[model samples]
Target chain A: MTTTTAAPPGGRAARAAAPSARATGPSTSGRRRLAPWGFLAPAIVLFVLFLALPIGYALYLSFRTEKVSGLGLGSGSRTEVWAGLSNYAAALGDPEFLASVGRVALYGVIVVPTMLGLALLFALLLDSRRARARTFSRTSIFLPYAVPAVISSLLWGFLYLPGVSPFYDLFERFGWDVPSLFDGDLVMFAVANIAVWGGTGFNMIVIYTALKSVPSELYEAAELDGASQVAVALRIKIPIVTPSIIMTAVFSMIATLQVFAEPTTLRPLSNAISTTWTPLMKVYRDAFTRGDLYSAAATSVIIALATFVLSFGFLRLVQSRAFASEK
Target chain B: MRLTTGTRIAALAAATALLASACSGGGDDAGSDDGGSAAGPVELTFWTWTPNMEKVVDLWNSEHPDITVTVNKQDGGDPAITKLLTAIKAGSGAPDIMQAEYQKIPQLVSSDALADLAGSLGDDVAGQFTDGVWDAVTLGSDAVYAVPQDSGPMQFYYRADIFEKLGIDVPTTWDEYADAARKVHEADPKAYLGTFSANDAGWFSGITQQAGASWYGIDGDAWSVDIDSEATTKVAEYWGGLVEEGVIDNKPMYTPEWNAGLNDGTQVGWLSAIWAPGVLAGNAADTAGKWEMAPMPQWDADAPATGAWGGSATAVTSQSEHPEQAAEFITWLNTDPEAVQALVDETGIYPADVPASTEALTDPPEFFSNQPDFYEVAAQTAQTVQPFTYGPNINVAYSAYNDEFAKATKAKTADAFVDAVDAMQQITLDDLKNQGFNVSE
Candidate 1:
């Protein structure tokens, strides 16, 4: 992997300056600077320790490996040595790793658009004047987000089994032989359904909050222009919530690339999902199970780089378009 | 050449700086914890994955007031390894005694994470356990790393009622076993002789062991990896045909569906280790009296052999402050009759203690219809297990098997053996070579 261009120091300075600099009572640069620095110190320190240090260490470890001599029976036979980019090359060349990447790409294609579309629909319904039981529907929809991914996956894993699934009994009663949810062809959609169920509610809340932030005057002017609620929603509400939608999309894309827990938890229920079914799971298998930390570190670095490039490139494209439209 | 040297030097410098900073943060915390409490008792932290481990630790704690041992339960296998590795990398927070599976000992030993216990554990202590279990924890003739705790000797578990109904004798050879699979499935399309769990690599390894396929063996100074040997290929092709003809179910074991199948008589036979009886009895409570045990089928019925599966040992980490005391506890825990009994009562598996006499073995649990004596059968079976050491990165090989098994099972010809050889054996050889081991193919 190539070195990521270092984020600029001036960008931090600009961020530090842009937040409520003019609104502060102290017009003097020194007092205003002191307050922001004090507020930012804890976050900066945390960012360094939890994020930057680990990334740097992984980068360092990715390029180094242990060289063992003789039988490798003991510690004395092994010595840490520099391996350069061999681990990265191996990870890239590996068919299993490439297949996992391809699988996750397909999963993301199925999950993201479907999840965001449902989320947008829910948020619009909650905001609409004709909607009933707003609180009930909102709470019930968002309830799944409260369950941890492992627990949710395990719950769905059982429901996918024919022996235990109510759907199986229901289908059998109707003289319909329902295909197993864990069949190889349907397993991806089954996995994607769990993600969408757990994810859409949270995204809906984000878009709903953004919808609430829209000025009432815009809606009033749209009604004065004799526009229907659907027309107003399509033309005004969605366009205004574009930023939140883009943010959710980017976050989901990053998350989808690093999907590990759902498939791992669902593995015991199905034979179709392999140990290296996802790129992140392969990294996990390499590091812990295989005891090949160097390859794991390199693969993680590759995943991190991919996430950054995809998320940043997406944000940049969306931001430029959003800004252009506003102007 | 100059640029390469410069890069190496730079990388080394960066690594040193990283290590130095980490050391500075954690260097003082180690000696500080032991300072104030030295006069009272030497506290040792132990980690294990077995459920209801508190009883065993509590037994030890009550016996020895001088060294109070604290118990920490971790999820077994990969998670525990990850936690231990993290602790080692950070230079602290490792338990004094932790349980490492036999398959993982080589990997842990290569990392230098385990303490050499040869000095503390003499030949007398080492001689008590079974030879196969002993070799798993030892390096060459000396350098004992862990004490053997338990073993899983492969056994044949089948439904006697079903076999009687089919008028087929219990197959003692692979060829007869294949014939039995065909006859049983042909008789009832709803049932198969047994399942071939695509996800269970350990079971496959055990089968390979039973078939006398030594995938990894130490040859003088190098590790030999021959995963696609004639013996292994024979076993794979045998299973592949059964799977290809739809005589054997290709389902993952230990799932609810598998349990349902076993209980409902859709699965007539199971070939697994001694540890399976407990799980089978629990899952198939309705079919309690129907199951029975026999020696695992062999390549030659005249000379019987079996494979070894899921077993673990108590290993002392290199990070421990009191290695001698830790070794003492581990030895006592495995060798002492009372401790062995307690472990057996808690875990419901036979411990690999000297004399091999425990109530668990002597008294057959009522779950298996009281007809087949579990202890007598397993003890005899354990004796027949061919001693094999799972080489370093064995889990990687197992993961490869699980990853490629579906395709391999689909391929009807000898191509299945080729896939198994590539994924299970070749990948591991390449990985071990990359890790700088001398691998002979």
Candidate 2:
């Protein structure tokens, strides 16, 4: 009931870089840049409309909250009020949000490394001269990536259930005592598996494309040096694809933080996952289900900020090594 | 003022909800300012999730060409309410009328998304619904928000074949129910009598209601939350005990695994609402005729009690340009003898209109054909639905139930269940207080 903050310290969201920068060129003035500007107009308009405008509106909403008088039943009983940093503070202070962050961090730890490692391995195998039926293997591995997270979660959810799972039946037939995927701590792993299964192939394609871009002369030189295939891959292929790996890792990290659909879809099958199992889910619960857009906005901003810092900070930290390795 | 994490979030949410709704309400007034040109038959958009609802609406369209109603089927439950509220906030895209669950009525009313239909609906409409059903729409206030469509009085459904195979009788009391659960699980380790569905807050609320728990109370402008009351704790502990004892499954209901269990005979019974037959028939068609309906196991054998689960009513949105016509459509849709018969015959809902419903239901649902008097038992079950109050922040409370009970069931301890109740009470109370309500601690 107390208005915690007065000045509204941080609602602006930097507002520094306009979404569509003016087409800067050799001349600051004339119609020479007009053709290029016109060509880029569609992309600029889309970025402004879809991305920038929503971000600005969310920023504005995050600074505000409602003031309800009495029962909040009738019109005019509730009025929009300025709520400065309180929503942000509350979001950061919330244990559920913190727990979700922790869950996603753990999920990222499991998903990113395993996905990248497998992707790198597959990319190397596909890049090798001895690789056979490459198209079929590549397509088969990448097939799961085509499945949306919701559908994949549902597919994996059925496979995890004890009542209907063929795996559970198989385990029972073998008389092997396997812990349920939904049991206490295993639910996290169960969800991570879906993300990995759906993500590895895409990352593999990215690294493989980079591997294709690698000069064959380097492979011929390594072969002339009497290097084994494993030696050549580990020494040459992996190093050359490191930049692509770094880019994929950063994308995976951002995707990890923004995870919403998989755990949500799996929720019906497992009792272990809460409504706020991830930060994005909490934001969704707050905004839509609870009808409180302010908190949702603030929480999303926090997530966006976290994503920005983690991704950019990561790029900054690894830029020298990754780019140097590319040379 | 440093507050608890949940309370702080609740406070912020409460504030935004009020502000958003107030803004939308003003916009609603402005958007429709282009004169109510009363020329042609008023076209009303209705959002609902009942299957074959278009058929019933088609029936209305034929009879009353003046008022054309379009049925926009939604995903129903929480998602529909969320979508409606979002539309309300965005100041457009909302339908003329929406199907709202009883628990969600409070949240919708609190958001000012629903219009007051007391003046628009017919005078006799109030008499059509039972007091418990009516209390939900009105919130015990004079302002009528929605007309009752269907009622879901809780019932106990069991697989008779499984019961006979296990040599267990239908449980008549809570103690007997517990005993039967133990025996069933003992007979086959893979099977269970039922499950404690953490995902379904409505089912949990119904259980609490049967134990005589009223979660929220309103007096004047002040609100009181009692989610951790003795009645609720007792019910929670009972289920927790059974689950921890490995008699009842700790997993949720309405899940694929549960559906498979029903088909495979691992799931022996269901503590569900009257509309369960339709769901059972849809989920496990092979198990039909093997299932039978009974009154929920009693706390006291002499004094039976029950609670509503999935019933929903149609309400006119505040954004609607024609409240009168919308109200008229809903009233006829629920109360008219022909429309009520069509709803029962096509929609598979247990109609809330007391008089019209009794007349329409002559035979048992196909899933419960073995029980000659399905509606008879359902009608009797409907009478025992205890009166309970729902507050505007039931969403927060329900979300709290999902969060807290998920942890409790995972822990699989009766003590954890009690702890979960306390957590729900704390979170709900904090949310109410934080939302700037006059909540008494």
Candidate 3:
């Protein structure tokens, strides 16, 4: 009796409501399958137009060069021609480009490690129960993230000026000699400080959020096993947050390589920074100041490739140790 | 699954209608004909990097009632140029007028981004500006792309009280200047005469300009590099000697030490341009009436008294929808006596127009204690400027030379600096050659 009742229209309705109906049944396939595509259509269109189109255009432009016939006096005389690998060769061979890369690499070495280390330390301290004024310190340390990079650079630029600086005044009061932070030897560090100060808090919050995600039960278990808070942090907390740390490090590396805003903003005050101070700066100079967009495009592609390689290379090198247990 | 084919077709039609309208609205706003005379007032967008440009825009707006001019203040020289170039490439959204530096004119002209003003304004407009100003804006034999706005005539500004205390008079020659710097330093071990930033090649460029040297020369279809000329060497050597002598404060500009020096009288003087007086006054406001301007110490007694450091020109873009109105606005802003005077009163920018200068000579600024007529600066600018062509590869040459200068100054060897500059000149020539410039061997 039950079989007969279920086998009627009720069974047909249940079959229609089943998850595999659209995939397996021919009756429902055409009408049901287009919904996902419709949902994704807008986003796919936007992504292609805004992101993919410009990138493809830049790639095309990177392989082109201008040819000027005769005196290049008029519009018809100058024409765009395929350059192949010449622009890339020129960018790679450029001493200025190499110097900028070296300078930025050194800058990243100083900034990334120091900034992330401080951020992690601050985050860990904030997480500690015995730490005093956790709320105040966290807010104050994170306050700089609220300031824009340009504004931060401007503030630091003024502070580096001896006349307006309290540090300079204090040095004078003590009758001690003072050196300029904008000097050739120290300008990189001065720029790095601005980047670190502006970036540390945001990274700290990211790390802290990762730490907060760790269950208190794990800590309880560690404490029960006679492990101290410091030991638990060293053995468990840091290991658990390794993914977040890796993410921040990757981002910081990219930011360091594209160090244009801080140096550009600081330029008006100090004469130490040239037009081609960074790779991105050099790209800007070629594209605009020098009016050689082909070379600029070539250089940009090279830098982007370098960033991708470095990020992945570093990730791969650390991934085994960082996410081994998680996997 | 059981729906009729007609219903599906109707749904598709409705979706197409919605998508078409959305796409059309987006395209319409982005691609509207800028030249069309709409019911509303015509708006012109002007781009400038200078903070003082706001004042200039205000002056222009007050005088022109029919057209509204919108000013977009951008930062960083290179970024502004990038934005301008991108807008031009996009074939729309470009500003009607832009403030371009004199050195940048060559690159802009080469790229065909600027509108040739000479054809519209005629030879009389070119004649109205001083020769140096005119030459800086002209590319090859083509019409001028930019209208001369102001000249950055280099001068030496010193703290009068500090100089008096140290018993140092303004020097006439480089030698005398060095001697005075030494005396000032000896009198007050804590004081240095001026600051030089290693990256700022403007000082070296100004010195070269004063020495009657050109960075590039047109030789048939090719451009010749003259950055390693004897005049350039002389200027580099003189500056190198000053740096080595430890008389000039080696403090990098915009650094904390330099600002401190300005405030507390640690820096005695600085060799700057006409626009510098305003900068110095703003930065060292507490030291008002304490500073005074003097002729820049020449390399030799026979050297010219003036040279440009940095200045900009106003140019109407080729993409401007209202070229006639744009040209009119540029002419009035440049040549009108009242507009020029208002600009000077508002921003301390000396007018490039001779007639405007003549009118401005009547009113002296009280800020400088009425020491000299402010318009006298315009007169000096007119007297000392010499014609110098700005070739297409000028920016590249300038950057190479600046880096070379820094190395030489740091090395404390004039000869080494000259060698470096010559090497850089070669590199610049090579780069330009690759960029399609006809570089002279």
- TM-score for predicted model 3 compared with the true structure: 0.84
Ranking by DockQ: 3, 1, 2
Off by over 4 Å in 1: A1-36, A212-237, A319-321, B1-41, B57-63, B165-168, B358-360, B409-414
Best by TM-score: 2
Per-residue lDDT of B110 in model 2:
80
lDDT of 3: 0.74
Model 2, span B326-405: residue lDDT tens: 89999999899999999999999999999999999989998888999888999999999999888889999888999999
- The candidate, 2 or 3, that scores higher on DockQ is 3
- Report the lDDT tens digits of candidate 2 across residue range A1-327: 134463243333333333223335445435555869888999999766545555666777888887767876866666778899989999999999999999999999999999999999898899888999999999998888999889899999999988889999999999998988987789999999998999999999999999999899998999899999999998998888889999998888888887888999998788899999999899888887777788898887787777778989999898999898457
lDDT tens digits, residue span B1-441, model 1: 001111222233234335533764684477457534558777788888887777887899898988778889898766887678667666777788988888888878876789999899856787777777888898555789899888888998899999999998998888888888888899988688898877888889899888888778888888988787777788888887788788888778889888888998888999988887788878998888788888888898888999988888999998888888889889878887788888878877568775644543567767775565667777788889887767877777788888777556545444674666666777778878887788776
Give the alpha carbon lDDT tens digit for every residue of A1-327 in model 3.
Answer: 988987878878887778675477775676477878889989999766545555555676778888765444434556889999998998999888999999999999999999999999999989987889887998999999888888898888878876677788899899988887765658899999998898889899999999999999999999899998899889999989999999899888878877888998986566567677898888877765666777877787788778778878999999999889878
Residue A5 of model 1 has an lDDT of 40
lDDT of each: 0.80, 0.86, 0.74
Q: In model 2, how large is the Cα lDDT of residue B118?
A: 84
Quality class of the docking in candidate 3, CAPRI style: acceptable
- What value does DockQ give for candidate 3? 0.27
lDDT tens digits by residue: candidate 3, B79-126: 777677666555555688888888877766666668877667745677
Candidates, ranked, lDDT: 2, 1, 3
TM-score of chain B of each: 0.91, 0.93, 0.86
